[model samples]
Target chain A: MLNRPATDTQVTHLQRLWLYVLCGLVIFFLIVPTLLVIPMSFSDSRYLDFPPESWSLRWYRAYFNSPEWLQATAVSFQVAFLTMLLATATGTLAAYGLHATRARSSRYMTVLLTLPMIIPVILLAVGIFLTFAPVGLNSTIGGLMLAHTILAIPLVMITVTAGMQNFDINQEMVARSMGASRPWAFLTVTLPQIRNSVMSGALLAFIISLDEVVIALLIAGGDKATLTRRMFLALRDEIDPTIAAISTLLIAFSVLMLTLSQILQSRK
Target chain B: MTAADHQPDAPMNERALDRQARAEQRNLMALSLPAFILVGSLVLLPMGWLFWMSIYGADGFTAENYTRLLHPSYKKTLITTFELAFLVTGLCILLGYPLAYLASQLKPRMASLVLLCVLFPFWTSLLVRTYAWLVLLQRRGLINNWLMEWGLIDTPLKLVHNFTGTTIGMVHIMLPFFVLPLYASMKTVDYDLMKAASNLGASPVRAFWQIYVPLTLSGLGAGVILVFVLSLGFYVTPALLGGGRVMMWAMQIERSMAVYADWGAASALGVVLLVMTLGILWAFARLTGAIGATEGK
Candidate 1:
């Protein structure tokens, strides 16, 4: 693309070097903060001091031994599990329906399903808190799961719909025209074809629920607090290395899930 | 075995196939019902409740909550929200554009590896990322310690708990959102166009600005709208890094609810935010002549 091969070699070389250096700095800025926490979490100091004079696993031990932290972890896992199941089921079904029907309203439905993602979480938190309080659903595990499922469904829908785009519905039709029942054809044929999408969607839903905090802060309380909500409170009230330890673990889990999803997508 | 026997069953088979097709369509529509009901009852109903609470007063329906928005402090919060969003969005564009250009120019494999820098932060938890900034930007933080150790200054810089700190943290979070779209669009620009422009005696920089930059405007616009909207509603990063000095709309709604216990006021602020967001999206769609641009996220 550099057509001025004779006259501009020196200047172009300098420009290329400058571009590389600038991008290298930007990449460093993006990833260093996240990477620094792993070391900080292992620091032996009571306060956050980078390049600790000493290193220890004291914060990891604290995270493990504290009942409240363990309980919050458990609540996060439970909510994430339920959200994965609910969102995957509902979202996959909707994707299939929308793909098959090809109705005019499908566009509107897609927009509606995506609203939870587009709208601010704080607004939804306020809305849910007000609506659920009178119905006695606030602070309950069910309430948190419901809110998370709403958030996760759109992601699942998008993934599954993309998967369906590559799927040929005629295969299912042929299976049905033979001897298989509708449900059987879907289970044995369509479901297997889109299994990767469904799995990735479930993983994404799990991650979303695990990381969600704002709604959990406004609605979840007492024994049902999510790990992130607890982390938020901890940061506000005190600076603890235990929070750092948990952050490291959460980061590791997210990296693992994202890598797994990438592998799943690549295999297809 | 005979033509007559086949002829007798042909119409029956065709009718059965028609019935089956209708059933399948109905079944497909039925399959979507569970998700529809869930969204309607949980998401839509609660949003309606929010709107209702905004207008509902102690005695009857009223616009008092919205009129309260005209007050000076509330107006300041709204203006600050937009200003902060624009500042973060502008920084993302300025920083992200070059990085995206760099990536777009590289070989595909190396480009993705560089893009991973952006994606890693995207995949990480917002709270964790924000907390990392908190650790690095606080009064006794890493940056300050390094600066002081180098004898640059005796006192630690007050980086955290203010507008500067909040902007830094937010830009860190929002950088990838801008880069991914911008890079995707940049990759689609034909490099041969630049080559042709240069062959016509245009300098490389002139070719880039005149040809390449114009081609990337769609992606740039999409990225701007996305980062702006997301930053407008940001709650966590500012709350953690702002040290109570920076106030955005999301935090205001939280304060109205938690501190003031004024649902009407909170809901009213929420409605205003929602309207503003939708208005921006609608205006972008009108300007772009497509809704696809607004779906950048």
Candidate 2:
């Protein structure tokens, strides 16, 4: 009402009140579930009591002290870091290839590359687990990285392909016309221009691996447990404040990564 | 040379240039081969192996696992899965349409703020959001606690560990997937069309029905299909929140392997899911030619 021109105020002012109230409730439903956990993390009770009568950081202390939780957290970071590197290297190459090629097969190649994302994660997890079981690769660090890298490839490819849209391919052609090699032209001219999106894709790749739950559940277990795997099992058994603490940390880390990725994409 | 120079009869050494272009395409495609191989061996190869697993039983080649899908229990699971999918998709549309409309009408900066709020849960770990709901809706949990204190009810409602709990959690996860695309489509509508209708002796409600609603129908259809398709294969939310009563399709596959250790049954279930998910996506792509809208989901 305040923002609109004075002449039209009477039209929307009273009539829109119902719309505003309805939307406010829906928006509250959307945002509150995520923020609800933040207060629960500070609870001093054994169970997750909201609007707690007491408060402390003891769950955070519990998480820091437990070897199992710490080990799971470390494994998640290690796998996510490795997945980031591998997916970025291969996926960036694939995106560049898709951008450069004029062949009709390029469309089919795109469909194949993106199939990982379109297929349900449970199906992929089951397949990977079955394939890995016989070779003793299931629950291993390398297997999880391979599984996660497949999922992350489409994300990296999507961002980098979008990034290449603003770039003039003619600039690279000019570099090549001056006797520079294709690889040399790309390294010197194209990489610097699209580095932000590549970096953003890398960040997204990291986040995807860290928060992955289904694949980790089937293929990751025992000492190879990822943070989400442990959290899922823990939640199935109980709802302790320690899990809340870990959840809070995971939420904070993903928010940071997503914000950084968004900033990177928006900049270029 | 311009693009026309590449035409067969218009250019110098046209066939030679065509050959060179084809060679260049292959060379560039070599860059993608490693990623291609990774996805193929990891996804396609295992999926083929699963297909092989499905067709075999203890004796030799057999259709026992596929035949087992005809049993009453399997039918119940399939029916339950589709029913839940319908229910969740319906609720999402009811809640999502209003929220998306509100966001679309806001100023650019304010709309993004609303979008950021919607995406906050999307960015959070799925498990965290499910856990938050579990805590809030459990019998001894916050919602029940508050309800009792307010004297709104004589007893705490059975919110969790049932069908209701699963629906709530699934709707929360699927809401953003519906809203983002619908909002994008909504932004492209010409508000002038509605105003012009009002000026032409139409009431406000008539203008909304005649002009505004038709413009947004395609977005609504897209959102409905995406939500229903996604809900068919839900695993985590239903498994955790439903607490074994729901028996969704994905959980059925998981149970066949985990509880019964029946590779044949599990493999068969996995194959069916893959077929259904891809089939729907392909059919939708063919019908609407908007496969690009499936991005980010």
Off by over 4 Å in 1: A1-13, B1-23, B290-297
- Best candidate, TM-score-wise? 2
lDDT of model 2 at position B91: 97
User: What is the C-alpha local distance difference test score of each model?
Assistant: 0.88, 0.88
Task: Extract clashing residue pairs from model 2.
Answer: none
lDDT score at residue B165, model 2, on the 0-100 scale:
96
Q: Which candidate number would show the highest DockQ if scored against the true structure?
A: 2
Worst 10-residue lDDT window, candidate 1 chain A:
A2-11
What's the CA error at residue B104 for candidate 1, in Å?
Answer: 2.5
lDDT string, candidate 1, B1-297, tens digits: 889879988999999998877776777777878888877877788888889989988889999999988999988888888889999999998889999988887777898789777888877898999999998988788999999999999999999989999999999999999999899998898877877887888877788789888889889998999899999998998888888889999999999999999888998999888988888987987887754556564
- Lowest summed lDDT over 10 consecutive residues: which window, candidate 2 chain A? A2-11
Q: How well does model 1 score by local distance difference test?
A: 0.88
